[model samples]
Target: MLSACFNIISVCLSLPSLSHLLCLSFSLFLAPSLSEGVSQMFGLVVSPLFPQGYPNNVLETWDIAVPPGYAIQLHLTHLDIENSENCEYDFLKVSVDGVVLSTLCGEKSFSELRSTVNPALYSTLGSMRLTFQSDFSNTERHTGFSAHYSAVDINECDDPYTGCSHDCSNYIGGFYCSCQPGYLLQEDNTTCAVNCSGEVFSSLLGSLSSPSYPGLYPENSACSYSLQVEEGFQLVLAFEGVFDIESGERGACVDSLRIRAGGREWGPYCGNVAPKDPVVTNSNHAEVLFNTDGYGANKGWKIKYTTKAKTCPDFVTVNSVLEPKRPVHQFKDQVRVTCNKGHEIVIGAKAKHHFDSWCQKNGVWSDIEICEPVDCGPPKEIDNAELKFINESSPTTYQSQIYYECEAPYYQINTDGKAQFTCEADGMWRSSDGKLDIPHCIPVCGRPSNPLESIQRIFGGKPAQLGNVPWQVFFQSPRGGGALISDRWVLTVAHMAQVDQPYIYMGFLDARNLGQGVKLEVEKMIIHPKYKRHLGDSSQYNYDNDIALVKLKGKVKMGPNVTPICLPQSEEEGQPELGKIGFISGWGRVKPRQTGKIPVSPVLLYAKIPVAKTQSCTDVKPTGPEIQKEKFVITDNMFCAGMPGVDSCQGDSGGGYAFQGEDSVFQLKGLVSWGIECGSYGFYTKVVNYLDWIRDTMAANED
Candidate 1:
């Protein structure tokens, strides 16, 4: 049983084998009445030497000491001593810092006993002392007593009895109370209270009111609120709840709410009425002051303020009508202004005519303008030319065209050889192409006129005079060709109108100088209903009704180089006699199907080919089943023109075929539709067949 007790004690103490030898040595020789103290660094085990009771009058005391921050824990594992009433004899007593905590006797055992040091007594260290006394009798003893003592660090912060109002900070032996910012610890050293005088706020949005707002404020109190926002913004303050303060007979406020901003004072508000509108500052900073007299106070005022982007006063004005006619405008907004017809904008000495104004970031408008009436002044005189106004007198105004004629020898008047000048939208006399140069009369021809001059000899045909065939219109890119039939309408092949918004170049002589030509945007396209790619089968192709009308977004101002071709008065008047020579013009390839080749001629080129009999075109044999289809036969609405080497090629599909009329003017006879190959006999859509349709369609879509 003694060996068992030694083993149990050694395991409970977690001693090493060598330490276990020392522990056994100490347990066997430990004096019951020795005066030496037991320092419990790890723990101490207590037991009498024998299983029987100790000698008579036995008195033993143990002074257990731990570190300054630690407290002792005692566990009475076994106790068999002499039993006595009220622990008068053979009693064990435990005390901490000289204060008795527990007294044991009567063979009773205890599970645990901890140090009873007050955590609030932080200046003193924790310590305990144990006393064991026995009466002068050697009879009753059963192992006497056995106990284990351990030291533990005391945690004052975890004590539920602590009364720290704000925060509790613990040290080795004890703990203390601390207060947060804007709060002061009370006399009890644990409770805290807010320091209202130190209150301050800084942010884009916040609230400020009289002290104890929404309730009666104390007498003789004053508070100030200061707010700031971003550099380019201003503060807006709004008031809510009841507002009452001391007032005088003259309506002057004694105890009041005062607002100051941008070096200016806004209010000394008092009485029951609040401000009708929110107070806005002119700058980013604002100050609110609340003052109360030593008298009665009503429900205090509650006010909220937020920052808003700064704005500039209205400084922009327009001569024309404006979309938003407000007196003030915010930054980065656009103001649109438009002028009335026949009127333009005049900013300074120069005329602007049309545009919009922008409110810049720096709070300034891009342009300030007003609309004024248009006046073109008297027409410039040309040498050997006479000005002729539609009205007898000169009624010069916007969009008015003045007619002029060159005297006899000098037949050509304007720069483009057209005897007219138009007063444009900008109140200036200009040509159709926007040229500022004044027109002058010039001699019509430098060579003598001849009756039998062969027209098809010059470079293929002849380099046409700049204004000779003004109706010719050339497609700019994705190249093709067309002829103007009206002021804003061009007639071309349906295939030539494939581009979504094709640009047409007109009113220029040399095709290389295409920039000098006026480019018009195609707004609408109408292809003939009968137009088809494959008529009878996929192999057989047809271009029979390959006609389309292109409507331009704006009207073409007519000049010598840009004029509409004259349409025939009737279908009968359009059809020329068969076998008569007719001219076809285009900016197409010179040779038939010239692969990978650009047109050699940059100028408008023409070819004169005799109209072929229908039987002659029909007699041509089909090379394959593709061309042997019945629908591929020559019909009356189509006419064959050109022979072998001299024909309209690939790029000439949308050009015009015309012959001289009795009036000596060229009238449109046909439209280049398609051909068997490039140079072989080409078929043209006979314009005489669709004259009524053309006129009716144009009239219906007129702008």
Candidate 2:
């Protein structure tokens, strides 16, 4: 009710002063008798698409009351299908005052009798009672219907003269005709005139029909026609479904149809039909007119035969001719080789001849090349010496640092240490026997046990002749000979007073001259819980039993070259005929120095080396009988020696291996812990393997 009369005229305009006289007396009295009774019942409307059938399910709503000037018209009829059926048409909705309205579905069948008839609205959309909908839910038959009208106007010329050939123009209800300019509009709309009249009557209508109507507008007919040919005409176009006359922009131009109709392939339509005008000077036949307003607004059905390309002519093929073939190219090569004393190159040093060649593809070789073999290590002859190899010329890149210089009269003393070589990508060179620098002091007096001479005496000092004793003075004390086992105790090597800060470097022998010694603070250092150090191999005598006893914090002043060696009570009272040559002095190292650099010496230089048998030292280089059938067991109070070209390298850590007992004096027998490379072979520990726990840990450290 117009929203309850605009809410009672907005509560009578909130009654301040009768709100503009109640909206001007409610629009001069209830809006023109309620919009003139919904514009005369929405103009006695009829088919608002109700339960129709041709395809079934329909819906159409209603609601109008619009007034001022009006304009609706929706007249949609329905037959919605039949091109032999299956042209489905279900929901086709249309609206008006509620906007929406632009519909067309499954035509055919009077093309769903379409007509908005003037549905465009903006203002005069007053008496809006428009509503049309159709949703033929899976219809077996649902027809259509929509009938509306406000400012009505239909008169579709009621088939005027069926198709006037001249002046007709009358719309708002269709009708247009202005032919007589060469005549056209003729699809049974009462004909216009000449479509093609001449050349023996277009060759007697292309020899009696079968040319399927006259081009364009004649296909599925609707209206909008056009035709004119002042110059003879014979327009014939059959092209039905997939018509692709040699498709070159979908061919079919016939500006002058003098084509004698001689092509037929009917399936996809190309059934040619040209050949009209026989002479008016060959009439040059010309009549190409088509404009069914884009073929009645196209939706399939195109037979445009416009004619023009030189009076239509197309069809060509014609093959035959030959000669040509030639192509081939391939290659390989890229070399490299390397060696030293163990010599190399017994193969094309990484050769790759001509275009990187390696041949045999599918079997593997199209490219990847490699050739490695170079780490020539131990072969530089030394026993009775006679090695001379010199093939230098490497500034780096498979480098070669040869500098042994000892051939004039033999002075080469490199005990072998640091040097390098590396050149591989297969030219092989990373290592082929050319690396020797050896330093940490290698002298091996008379050549025997030189352990980078105790890291070149501590760091680097003692050389002038072993007696020039300044290999920095020395200080390695925390145990070992706990300086005169009594006299305030000192019988060392208990894993060196098991440190965690138990410092006791007493009376300096140069730890780079520890400010001249006397820094002892150990009141303990007791070893011989049956000592252990010898980790396997040396007949496995239960490890080094190195021994230890310390106690210090006082008692000093003793000389005879810092005196302290003398503990041999048994084994037949330290025999050499019984004790005397023991001077096994330390501050370690007789040869091991890779540049781990630490050693300066402080003094204390003594030597003795001689601890034989143990199978004559595993029979000089023996660890093989296939390594004791792969597990050789040689344990039993371990004891081995070194002499096959003598060795002991690296600052022979843990010092002493002295002998001579049998009374000729000299005692302590064995301590230097490791040696395989630096000395090639040197391991020791036995002072008679912990002589009864070093005499009961020196009698319980002198009580």
Candidate 3:
């Protein structure tokens, strides 16, 4: 209602207190142009009759609001009014959310006051109000004040006291708080908390207590705990803690506990003499409950429970469709489950849908069999090989036949039999004859183009024909030779490649011209680390771990005269080959050259020798410049291969000793490392021991 002096206004704001409700009537007055927001951006504000004589006894107010995320910024540019004691005669005031900013009277410019808290006032909650009053008697004419208000962005997110416990979002003049997906925002709209009614238990043995164990339980709470076990077991509850639940007169339960299970309900047991005996849940499932009144301070119940085998829940699978179903199967019954037609039972790696499953003495079925759709998926990918489907399949389910073939001229399936596999019902690829290894693509290697015919025919030592030993590396003179194990790698002894850049010659075999052969420049030389460490501070070097790989700067062109040798495929392949005859070829000096020219082998000479007896090899007194005075350690990593008339002599160091296996392919057995003399059963570093090292080094350094 409008009044002569003021408008009776009633405005209420919720203040944070015990009651949390507050209402205060503020005298509100809007003169012409005062109530206008001016715009959302600004609001024009001034006292009554600004810049002219003003009347008295006037108490008025103007309330301003801005958009969320922004606060109302009030700027007073001018101030001129009648002055009186304590500004009681006439005054203008600014406030926000019930907090007063300042009161002004008399004549004072916006800058006439201190820089702080005078010319401008801002609201924290995006709302601001002002009050103006005039005394009934004015001494003279005065222009009260001229001010403007606008929305200023309030960064609520930057304020730690904004009440957001998690994520906070701010917009033009306001802000809000939010929580993660699984959490619920509490009543305050700022806290994220998980709301759960009770707890769940799955263990075989445990105890449940109401809220706190020893202390008094919480007030005004209704909680439930759920327990579930395997279908055949019955849950048993035994109450054992202090029975102190609140109760009314005549021992009625004011606070109580209840149990519900298998269509049976237990008591609202209270006044707790503590249910002295145990309560049996005749079935497999159960739920325990504990409720309380608003007023209660008592230690609640504690239940120690155990499960016993009893009547079990019915069993049947939707997909498998086990037959002879029952609504309630007893633990004592020995009934068996059977699958319907078109489905066969599988037990591990076998097919026996029926008898594979059995009822155990513990009342639970062991190895419960199930029927499934026969599917083997796509056959596993075979390295270096592709497959051809032949059976009725796209081809990988039941009865799918697949044939594997190696990737062409460089590789072949290492089997005389058909390289085939079939997907059986057991979900595995099996051969027709439950034998033979899976199809693997092995390199077509170790085979020589120009054969040596027989090692015996060579007798003691002779020059190899151009392609007789295709895998031999022709390192001129006594520098050190190697075996071409791959297109770009050569295997040799570590001691021979002590120099950083060792050169390799392939294709042509000419010791006379030396550098005339095709020289393969070495890019990297990896010596056995153990062999390198054997070069410690000692008078003598043990050539025990003498093995190294040389990587050629470029791949060697394969032809009739240049090819790779095969490595030992299996772990024990070279072990049983103790007494086998092998060949070692090198361009070494049979005799020293005169006048600064060390004589290389006139041709690539190879020695036909048998692997000597270990006793005879280790029996001899060791000699040689490399062996020095140290005892020759004939470790298992070295083999003795040579007789009196046939041996890898001094200049044969680092040469590969190749053996023609039963497959008619040459596998490098060893490398000529050290010997007592030019003969004395030549000691070669066994190639088998370092097979993994060779393969790993080559694979890691591949281009």
Indicate which candidate wins on TM-score.
Answer: 3
| Location of the lowest summed lDDT over 10 successive residues in candidate 2 | 313-322
Error of 1 at 96 (Å): 99
Instruction: Compute the lDDT of residue 520 as modeled in candidate 3.
Output: 84
* Candidate order, lDDT descending: 3, 1, 2
lDDT per residue for candidate 3 within 1-703, as digits (tens), equals 1111236788777766647667777786544465444336565676767667556787878877766567777777788878887887789888777888888888875677436544468776877778898878876778777776777888889998887756899876678898766456768787654332457887877988877766787655567789887776778999886878899988888988899997898988887588877888875678988877657688887899998667544554323543355665555555555554434666667665454333443446555666654666677676667878897535776667888887665556766556888767566777777543577665557877787767354546687787787777765433667888877788888877777656568766666665645678889989987885456555444778899898998866666777788888877885526677888887665642234665556677887777887676666554434444346566888978777656676557888888888778888888988766554576889888988888898899988
Model 1 regions more than 4 Å off = 1-460, 509-512, 533-540, 594-601, 620-633
Report the C-alpha lDDT of model 2 over 585-616, residue by residue, as the tens digit: 45555444445664533445554344555554
lDDT (C-alpha, whole model) for all candidates: 0.68, 0.37, 0.72
Residue 271, candidate 2: C-alpha displacement in angstroms: 14
| Number of backbone-clashing residue pairs for each candidate, in the order shown | 3, 110, 13
